[model samples]
Target chain A: MEAWVRKLVTGCLLTLPVAASAVAASEQAVRVAVIGNSPPMSYVDESGKLTGFNVEMAHALCATMKIRCNLLPTSLDKVVDAVSAGEMDFAVVSLLATPERRKKVLFSKPYYRSLSIWLSKPSIKPGSPRTTVAVVNGSVQAQHAENQGWKTKRVTNHREISTSLVAGDADATVVPMLTAVSLMEKPSLQALGLESTVLSDPLISGDVCISIHPGRPELREQIDAALDEIKRDGRFDRINSQFLPFRLL
Target chain B: MFTTSRTPDNYRHKLGAGVLLCRLTAVFSIVFASAAAWLAVDQHALLENMEDLQSRTLPNSMEHQRLARNLEVLRLEGERVLAADNPENRRQALFIVTLMAGHPSLLANEKARNLAIETEIFLTRAAQGSRIDENIRDEWTRISRHLSLTADDISVDGINLAREDVRQMNGLVEQTRQKLHGAVALVLGFLALLLLLIRRMILRPLQQIDHALSDLRQPGSAVTLPNYSLRELASVREAIVQLHGLMQEHESTRDDLQKLAATDVLTSLNNRRHFMFLAESELTRAQRYGRPISIGLADLDHFKHINDIHGHAAGDLALKAFADIIRSTLRHSDIAGRYGGEEFAFVFPETTPQEAVALAERLRAHLDAWVIPLKNGGHIRLTTSIGIADASAQALEDALRLADEALYQAKASGRNRTIQAKTTQLPLPLGGHTDNSGHSA
Candidate 1:
């Protein structure tokens, strides 16, 4: 009876480890939510189908890493909230990687970049020191203006910033380079004496990236590896082609 | 206590009938005049309200169109700025922003001030260098986000507030229109109802009373008019009852006075003097108004022979029936009266010489066809000779003499026929004889 018991105990020990391995394998399928809203980046269609540049890039990255992916359709503001709350694994909103936002969530390498421009009243001389500079509150451009020792004021909205420059409340203000280019083409801005100068040390540069939950090092490493593979295989170029004319940095 | 005299009772009945007829006629005229005046006032008010609505709508529509045009101009300017390429383009954009801010309604909001600051930052970056910096681009994004938020707020909240204001204005306009229409309808409705009541209670009843009085004037008429419901109409009825009584009491006295005056007592027809007075008055009216005047004279073929053959009573009956026929043939505007024993006269004002001839011929034919019933159960055939004369504005004596000559000619030519005499130099009637009686000119 003692010899038979010893053999049975050895068989039980091997079977127990096999069952545990099966449970761990099932649990290894990671579930992640990516929040975004920009067209050709991430958007939900009339059919409730999610699509766009961010969606395609996320999928490509997920396939490389062999991980399950999910897209959460939300406004740009909600993207930051979702990522911070851990309700989402990450977000792909075209958010500028600013110092303030970095305090709350980790950002990946910038996937896109854009330049800052100086907008001003046409009546004010281009290089005048008295020209008032306007920037959005809590934005990277505001920090840049503050660092340059330029006369800066905080504004609530971009439209108001434009209006303030026209109204003589501010002689100049900061905005995206593309937006400034678009504004210059309009006849109304000409009649209002509006002009713009693109800054060499850009007032701000917008870099779109995925925002992860704070301190998720293992997941971060996995996403980084997947992104590196996507970049290497020329998938990023294919994704960017879908969003041409709006160049991705 | 109930000892009533037959004479006084008969007098009272006649007086009551006469007084009631007079009062009813007076009340009918008054009510008709009041209704006409009220209708005139209501028509005027309706015209004034229509004018008011037209004036108010025109100016308001013009103002709304002007504001819409201004908004279009501003939108077009905004488009141009978005397309141009230099630092000046940013200034243009800023100018449009400021223009929008200056609008009183937009300036009241805190969001407008925030948008102004964002605009200045955009301008500053554009002026700094040829290429836009990264920091400025992020600032532009934040400004764009805030602008979109404020635009959404304005659309969802501000537009709703404006919609409420527009709705209230519309409600006020509708209410004013309704009130004006209601007032006009009420005034017109009251006038129509009052006219209906007046016709029923006053005019119709007055006409009935007049018919009753005419019946009482006949030898034996037992017709009695129905009493009116209203107090004023009842008072009129009472007055007619008093007048009827007075007429009964004065009948004999009036007969005695008629024998001395110019009226025939038996037939109660106007006598020679009264006929002459009426003819003169009609001639004067014709001359004043420039209308034609005519006269007709009729005489029995053999009045003395009838008095001798049929006796005096038979002669009297024949004269009475002939007088009744003459009165029936004459119109209400024409004057018919006894000239002498068996002769009658008529004054037809506003009648041409041709019309007078036709009327005289009709009278003669009617007399020839008459069958006068005698007391002895037999009917007598009667014939009369008639004469007619007309003048526009000449001497009355000449007209009378001409008519008398026509009568003599009729008798000479063989009785029971009519002859007409025409005067020279009569005025021609206006509007050349176009038979426009049924057709409008």
Candidate 2:
């Protein structure tokens, strides 16, 4: 019996570090990215905490995967670069998984769809010298607008797009449907004579997938399975109903 | 139905062809109905999508089509601004362009929203006391035509989206067809499996039962019983087993009754009637095969005198001793029977007349030495007189008559002797114990 106990002790000692390392790996903090000022999609609350559809979805996905996540607020333009560079494990922001972006990063199954829209007043024509359409710098909409040879005033975030329109620096801005909805929610922006026109352009695929870190295909599969799990369990619908007026799925 | 070695207890539990067919029909019906329902639902969804495109997307495109038409008029108005046909044409052109630029399609298309927005701005500036110069006309013409092209592209995009929707509907139809084929294949496979089971469990067992019934008529041919899974077939097999047992019982009973009819109870030998039957048949076979055969009659010497001297019990004991001697002396081919009273008949097959005399002498000698014990401690020595005749060349009746005459001659000469009938008109003195000695009680 003494000899058996000694053998068991030796066996446990040999396997202890392997078990501990696995625990450590599971316990490691995964950095999740969120944009600063895309309301209802992701934005800072009054308490200076990031909380929105994307942040809540990230939390739910982490819960499904049973892992710890750290939501990091980043600029809208830097989400793709941060994830591709492995600085962030994944981003829950609404980024269209276009074919060009697939080369640099892996994408989960699309969580929702988006469309390009022009946010402006009905009387004031968009993209005038005085009413130049405001678009986020380094975004698909900005690229599409520049490629289409339209006059654009580049901004950094959704808040700036809304503010530049209200401040009279820009009279119109081409944004996604959700952001347009967000801006339209502000009666101040509406009272500022701002309206929205939804667009159907060939350049817009509208499929918003979770952009995962490049080279982490296993994590991508884990995220995809977790995403499907969340959708199946009604967590996705719950989040969609809480954040969006229209169904995302 | 098959009847073989099967348990009667739960044999009823096994599924028969009818039940199996019902279940197969149910499963097939369910599968067919499910496939139909699935396809119907998919077709309905496809139809609804097409309807959505027709009712919603198509009507929505009319708005864009109007926008395109409005842009063409705006471009013509820009041409009027460039023509300078009247000083008021510039203000009128600006008024027309501004109202047309406010159209939703102008702002909806990223490419054209800005072009129309900026053209409206330039026209406003020119209408506000600015000169309608070549640079202003050039800008107005360029922006208005570009916006017109952009409006046309937007309208066409709506139609292309509709075409894509129709293409997707086509894909759904193809997918539904594949599902239907899969369901059909599943149904066919299940039908084949059901048929195989019927052949194995039903048809094959029935065939084996049929073979067993046909084989039952041949004696000693083993009946190969079938193992039946179905209860009805098993009960049939059990009934067949009972029938086979009854046939065997009947055969054994027939054999027992025949034995009782032909055997003599007292002597454990054939009786006179059956003995005659056997003798006649043997004589016929001997004559046909050209084989020698003999007949003989033997009597105990002074059997009644023994009964008169020492009670009938001692006489019967003496007769039984004589029968024992006859039984011990006969060959396998020889037939012997008690022919009423003290007489016993014998048929010696494949035997010559001289051989018959030799065997009869041996029987007399065996009887002569035999002693019957009496209850009074008295012993009776017994003997028999035998008469033999060759029946190979004569009819059975003539042979018996000749043997009877020879027996009379032997009784005239003496008692306790064996005699051979004269078939060649001469006797070779074939009688044993034909001396002047008789029974001494």
Candidate 3:
């Protein structure tokens, strides 16, 4: 009788979390990829944890859908690649659905877009052949500048590109205007008396959408439906208000 | 055979078409070139717009979302600054707020940028003082909320702008496509016109000329040259006609000149040079065929004395009368010519020396009986001296010398008589007065 009781206790202990997991799985399960280095979207904070607009938005969406969301933090490019490879269920990172990328991954409806702005030292002219521009490596800005035949200095991040511009390694840089604004407030920039001006009339631009692996048709439908629901129910607005100055869909 | 030494006219215009068609072609070429260049420029502009959409405007819209996030982060950071219990946490929050405040997208919006600056200033002051009292927190809270709202407005404005950009780009693409289609149609139309012009105005005329030239080349061809419609081609046809006319005129003139060169203008008979040429050819024929040939020398009797008595006009009339008599008396195959001022020579092909003497005697008798009525209404009687010799192959010169000696003998014996040279080696006859002229009184 004692042996049976002990066996029953162990069985119960094992079945409890399993039953909880099963229940959770039956409700909904999603692995969401978020960029770890991109600020204002998703970034690793001082605590070395994924936290940003996209990360928070993902959590909010999971809460609304009554599902379990596993957030995967990685580089922007890897996040998209991983989601397309089915290593993650879907990516919440700001990824563009260009025709080339669409061949590899299925994309959700566009959630956001960006405008390109020119950043130059006060004295340098925008788009001059003699002027060297710094662009973020692996960014649309880099491709745009290269296509224009502009002399380019490549850097790993937007801040580094701005820093190259401020350090006189580049005469100008092309970045998202919002990212440039954040770099402008750098203490090092202030100390060096380095200033940058945003040139008017944007050069090139892109839009962002959630990407999914090609085989996940049910998940894609669920996401699309959930997104539609949030948008209709004002939950999306609420989430957007927490991060964006306006609603994004 | 036909002959000419003519050269084609020097032409200044290089084009095959006439001046008017050339001018039209020039105008059309300019129009086509201008249109093509315009199309190229328009295509380049469309490409530039596409580049702008891809690199600048679309990216701007996407970054606008980031801008909204940054502004939200800033507002949250401000809130955190207000909620911080410790100075270090408050300082970190303030730092982030300051960074977001200077953001480029925020700076682009006046209201949002101003509010952000205000919030940054407030946070900086609060952080320095190491205190965020209740009233100060409330002020920070109000500013943050306003900033968030303003930023939201900016985000929505940016999205609208991006959509507008897309709409304009679509319209531009359509406009460009339509323009390109029109340009292609225009170019094709012009090309077709050029081809038709070549066939009608240039090629057809050329083909006609080609056919006319080929017909002209055929033996005994009488085909007329075709006319042309194009001015230049018409001019070419006119030139060819004029050249043909000139060639005909030249041929007629050449015939006249040749006749004048070989004939005696006064008597319409072969001159001394032509007579000698005929005699040489006869001599050659006699040698080759072993045929007998006879030659004779004749002279008008007392021709110089008559000239001295009757005046030069009467002398000329008498000489012309003698030449007419000689022409009437000679056989069709026989050759006669004025040897010099008053001397005549004859070549009777296939006739013996006896037959030639008989002909000479007949000629002398006819001249002796002839009478010329002068302009003065007086009759003048005339007579001739004749000598005949048998000419064999390769002995024409010797024959001629013998005949001349015999004629001198006859003139000495008495004029108006015929004499025959017996042989080429015979001495001159002696029973006559010496008269240097081959004539008698």
lDDT of 2 at B298: 81
Q: What TM-score does prediction 2 earn? A: 0.51
Classified by CAPRI criteria, candidate 3 counts as incorrect
Candidate 2 wrong stretches, greater than 4 Å: A1-249, B1-156, B163-178, B185-189, B196-201, B218-229, B306-328, B372-379, B434-441
State the DockQ of every prediction: 0.07, 0.01, 0.02
TM-score of each: 0.27, 0.51, 0.40
Write down the worst ten-residue block by lDDT for model 3 chain A. A194-203
Stretches off by above 4 angstroms in model 3 are A1-249, B1-227, B241-249, B424-441
**TM, chain A, every candidate:** 0.56, 0.86, 0.76
Pairs of residues clashing in candidate 2: A120-A195, B2-B233, B3-B237
Per-model C-alpha lDDT, please? 0.63, 0.75, 0.71
Which candidate's lDDT is highest?
2
Candidate 3 local lDDT, B138-239, one digit each (tens): 787688778778768767876986788778778777877887888788878888888897797788878877776666445444436565556567667666
Displacement of the residue B226 alpha carbon in candidate 3, Å? 5.7
- Residue A68, model 3: lDDT of 84
Residue B259 miss distance in model 1 (angstroms): 99
lDDT of 1 at B118: 50
